[model samples]
Target: MLSRPDVAVVGAGPVGLGIAWRCAARGLRVVVHDPAPGSGASHVAAGMLAPVAEAYFGEHELTGLLTASAARWPAFAAELTAATGADIGYRTEGTLMVGLTADDLAEARRLWAYQQGLGLPVTPLRPSALRDREPALAPRVRGGALAATDHQVDPRRLVPALRTAAERAGATLLPTAVRRLSDVDARVTVVAAGCGAAALTGLPVRPVKGQVLRLRAPGGVPPGFRHVIRGYADGEHVYLVPREDGEVVVGATVEERTDTDVSAGAVLRLLRAAVDLLPELAEYDLVETLAGLRPGTPDNAPILGPLPDRPGVLLATGHHRHGIVLTPVTADLIADLVVTGTPDPLLAPFTPARFLPPNPAGPVGVTGPVGVAELAESADSAGIAGSAATGGSAATAGSASVVRSAAGVAPAVPAVGGRTGPGPSAPEEEHTWN
Candidate 1:
C-alpha cells in the first residue's frame, strides 16, 4: 500500500477519475475507491457535449456551468490523450436538432427562441440547409437549429483514458466500494459516487433511470452521417449520434426510478422514433440496449463543496443527465477545493451548504485520521456494514454494472492510506458497445 493519501475519492467514474488525475498531477497524494472502476453512468453515457442544446428556460445558472464545462472539453481531451497515448474519440462534427412535423417545428422554434433570448450560439437552419448538412435526415424534416459548438466523445474510451492518466499521475486506484468516510485515513474524503453518496452523507441524491440503444450502420450502405441528430417525432426526443467507427447511438427514455430493467416498450419507442427521423437506421443491426441511473437532486444541479456539519467530507454528486458534459469542470472545481481549502466562485451556486437547513451547525472537520481498526469499529457501532473487495458484477441488462445503491444495507469502508483486506477483484469480464 502507498503512504496515507492526502485526498480520497469515493467514485471511479469519469468525474471521480478526472479529479484524481488533476490532484495527482499537482503532486497530491490521492487514492480513489470504487468496487468497479470506470463502470458507472460513464460507461453508458452517449458522451454528448451539448450545453447549448441542454439549456432549459429557468436553469440559467446550470447553463453557465454546462457551457464552461463544454469549453474545457477540447483541452481536457487533448491533454488526456497526450498523457496516456490513448484515443478518446473526441468528435467535433456538431449537433442538429430537427423536427419531423409542424408541431415539432413549433416546439423547435420555441426552443430556438429561448436559446436566442439566452444569447446562445444557435443558428436557425432551413429545411434545405438542414438536408444539405445531413442528407441522411428524413426529407419530411421541417426546420431545426444547429449548435455548432456542441461535440461528443466516446465515454467508453474516455473512462479508460482517465483511469490511465490518473494512474500515471500517481493516483492509486482502489477498486473497493466506499461504505463510510470514517474508514478513510485521509484528511479529506470526496463523495462522488453518483447516487451512492446519498448513503454516506444523507444527501438528497436519488437515481433517475434512463435507457438507450446502440446500432451499427450497414457496411457501406446508405453511407454514414456526419452530424449528431436530435430529432423530434410524435413528441418523442430521439437522438442519433454517429461515432468514428460505424456505430450510431440512439437514446434515451427518462424514467424516475431505480429499476434497471431495459423494457421492450422503451426499446420500441426509441427505435420507432429514430427510424422515423432517419430511415437508414431501420436497416442497421441492433447491436446493444442499455439502461443506467443518473444521480439526481431536487433542482437537478450538482451539489459541490464540503458537507455542512460533517468534517472532512465533500459532496460531488447529483449531476443528473449531464454527468458526461460536466466532468471537466466538476473535476477542475473539486481539485481547486481539495488543493486550496478554498472554494472557487464557479462553485458558489452549487455549494453543499445551499441544501442545509436553517441554523446549520458551524463547519466541522474530522479532527485527525483514524486507524483501520478504529474506523471499522466506528462503522460497526454505527451499524454500517462493509462492502467486500470482490470483482465487479456484470452490467444489469446493457447498462453499467449494477451500481452499489445507497438505499441498501452493508455499507463499505473507504480504505484511505492502505487497504486492510484483499485487493478488489477484477472488473466483470464483459462486452461493451465500443
Candidate 2:
C-alpha cells in the first residue's frame, strides 16, 4: 500500500474523482483507489442532470440539494474541460415530462402542482403546445410540463474527463480495489464508492440496481432532439435522454437486491415506454443494454458528512439514482469537510447521522472515536454549518433520528420498500454498458 496521503478517496466513480480533483486543485496530496474508476454507474448512466424531473413524493430538501448541484454544472464542466482538454458534452437544453394519455396528463398536472409548491420554475404545456416545442413528438401526446433549468452531460465523456482533470490537478489514482478502511489513514477518508460502500467495515450503504438501453438513430433521422424526455406510462416512470451524437439513452428499472444483469424484458418495457412517448424512437437502431447499482440509503437521500462514530471518516455515497447529477456538489462538500473540518449548512438535511440516533449502538465506522455532539461542535466551529444546507451541514441533534439499537449492528443491506434485505456479503462483481 502507498503511504497515507493528505486524503485517500475510495470508490473512483464520478463523486470520488470529483473530490480528488477539488482537493488536488487546492494543492492537497490526494490518492484515489478503485479497481475500475469510470466503469461503474458513471459509465452506464444516461447523464441527465435533471433534478426537477426526478423529484418524488416528499423530497423537497433533496430537491434543494439537486437544484444547487444543477446550477454548479456549467462551471464544473468548463473547469474540467479547460484543465483536461476533454469535452464532457454538457448540455443545457432542458427537459420535458410528457403524458401520452389522460391519466398520464393528470399525473403530470399533479407533479406540476407539486413542483410549483416547491417554488420550482415549471411551465404547463397542452398537447398542441408541447408538439409546437418538440415537433418530433407524437401528435397524440396529451400534455407535458417543461423544466427549463434541467440539463445533461455525456457520462461516457464526463468520467474520463474527471479522471484526467484530477490527475492534472496532481491527484494520484490507483487502479486497485481497497479491501478495507485500514488501508489508509489520512486527515480524512471519503467513501464515494457507489454500491460498493456497503462492503467497507462500518458504512450503512447498499446497492439498488438500475438498467438502461442505448439506441442509435437510423440514417436520415434528423439529429438534435433537444431536452430530456420523461414519460408517465402504465403507472411507471420512464425517460429518454438524447445525446449530441445519434445515441438516445432510454432507461431504467429500480430493482432491489438483484445482481447486475441486463434483462431483455426490461429493455422491451423501456422501448415500449419510449415509443409511446415519441413514436419516432421505434425507427432507431437498438445498440446496447446495460445495468448498474446505485448506492441507495434508507431515505433515498445521500449520506453526506462524517460518519457518526468514525471521526476521521466521511461518507459521500448513497446518492441513489441522482449520483451523477449530484457529484460536483458532493465532491466540494467532501473536500470542505476534510480540509476545513466543516460542511456547508446546505448539506444538513443529508447528514449520515440523520440515519443514526443520538447514541448509536455499535462502533462508529471509520470516523474514529467521536460522538455526534463532538462532531457537530467541530463542524460548527469551522463555519461549514453556515452555508445553506444544500451542500453540507451539521447533523441536527434530533431530527428523523436513527438510533442503532442492538439490532442495527448487522451487516449493511439496501433498505428496500421500508425493510432491510439480507445482510452484506462479499462485494459482488458485475458490469454493464449502455
Candidate 3:
C-alpha cells in the first residue's frame, strides 16, 4: 500500500501537474500518477494560449476562466522557470485572425463583432493593413481582426517546466499508470485525468479527439511569426503557430465520440486549409502528425471544485480545448480549494453538482451526482470489479457552499499581468515562437 498523501492527483498532464504543483506549493504532500507523465494532450497542444482567438459560441464561462488563467500566467511562468531553470517560451505577441477569402472575411467580421459585444478588445484590420502588419500573409487576403491580448506559450517547454516545478515543490510523481485510485487513501483525491477520466469510473469525462500537424519552416520563412494566425475555410478552423526554431504547427481537427487516431482525411483537410490561408506554407516540410483527446463534458466547460456527493474528492477535468490556456488558473484554484477549503468565485459556475440532479435535502442513494460512490456502486452492480477498483472512494452528501469554508482557500489575488481583458494597447513585443 502506498503512503497516504494530502492529495492524490490522477493524470500527469498540465492540469494534473498544475494541481499537484499548487498542492505541494502549499505544503501538502501530493502524489501524482500517470503512465507517461507530461506525454498527454498538454504536450501535444499547439500552445496557442489565445483565449480571444479560440473563442466559441456560448462559452462565456470558459472565456472568463481563460481570461483569469491568462492573467495568472506570467507569475506562474516566472516562478516555474526560476525553480526549474527551464524556459517555457511564453510570448505576448498577441494573435491575428486573418481572412483569406470573402467568406473568411465575413466570418472574421462576425467574430470580431461578437468579441466587441463581449467588451473584449478587438481591432478590425483591412487586407492591406494586415499585410502591412504581417507581410507573410497572402496579399489576396481581404481583412482580419487583431486580438492583442491573446498570447501563447510553448507547450513542449511549459509541460516539462511544470513537471520540474512540481517535483521541486515536493510532489511525488509516479511514472506508473494508476490502474485504480484505490491504491492510496488521501484526504482528497482529484480526478484531473483528461480523456482517461472515464476509464477511472464515476467521472463523466470522455474523449473529444483532435489531430494536429507539425511542419518544419523552410528557408526564407521568417524565423518566427510574431502572432498566432487562425482562420476558417471549408467549414473548418485552421491555425498556423510558428515556433522560435522555425517549426510551424498547423492544426487541429475536432472529432467527437471516437478513438484518437490521426486520420489521413483529417490531415489532408487540415493541410489543404492551412495552405489556403497561407499559400507559402506549401513550401514547408511536413514533419509530424499526431492526435490527442480533449476531455469533454456535458456543458463544454470544466467540472471544477468539490463534488457535492463526494466530500474528499474534487472534479477538475473536462476543460476541452481550453485546457492549455486555463492551466495556471486551474492549478491556483485547485490548490486554493484543497488548502483552505474555499474555491475561486469563478469556479462556482463549473461545480460538478451542476450536472447532478438537484436534491434540496442533500445527495443520497445511488442516483445522485456522478461521484465516487455512485461510480463504484454502478461498477459493482455491473459486476465490474476492475472498474470499481479503479473508480475509488465513497461519496459525501451536501449542497454547494456559497461561503469561504477554510483558511487556505483563497490565494491573495496577485497583480494581474499578460495580455488580458480590454486594456490599453502597447507596442508589440518580440516573442520567441518556441
lDDT of 2 by residue, 1-434 (tens): 65436567887888999989886665556888887778888888999888888776789889989988888888888888888889888989789998888888898889888888888888888778887778888776788989998889988998899889889877888876776665555545777877777766345677788999988888735444777888887566798898767889898999896589888789888988888777888889998898988788888899877665454567788888898899888888666555444345666677666666554454432211122232233345544332322332222322212322212222111111211222223343343211
Number of backbone clashes in candidate 2? 19
Give per-residue CA lDDT, model 3, range 1-434, as digits (tens): 65446678987888889888876765556888776877777767998887787667788878888877887887777888888899888888788898777877888788788878888888998778887778877766778889998888888888888888888878888766655545435656787888766555355777788899998877635443567898877556799888777788888887775666787898999999888778878888998999887888878888777655344667788888888888887887776655444455667678776666565664332122222232233234444322212111111222224322321221211111211233113233231100
Give me the candidate number with maximum lDDT. Answer: 1
lDDT tens string, model 1, 328-413? 88888676555444454566577676666633333332211122343333234433222211111111121111221111111122
Worst 10 residues of 1 by lDDT: 391-400
RMSD of 3: 13.6
Q: Global lDDT of each model?
A: 0.75, 0.72, 0.70
Instruction: Rank candidates by TM-score, best first.
Output: 1, 2, 3
TM-score: which candidate is best? 1
Clashes of 1: 2
Clash pairs, candidate 3, are 243-433, 244-433, 244-434, 309-396, 340-408, 340-409
Off by over 4 Å in 1: 220-223, 360-434
Taking all chains together, the TM-score of candidate 3 against the true structure is 0.81
| Candidate 1 residue pairs in clash (backbone atoms < 3 Å) | 179-412, 387-412
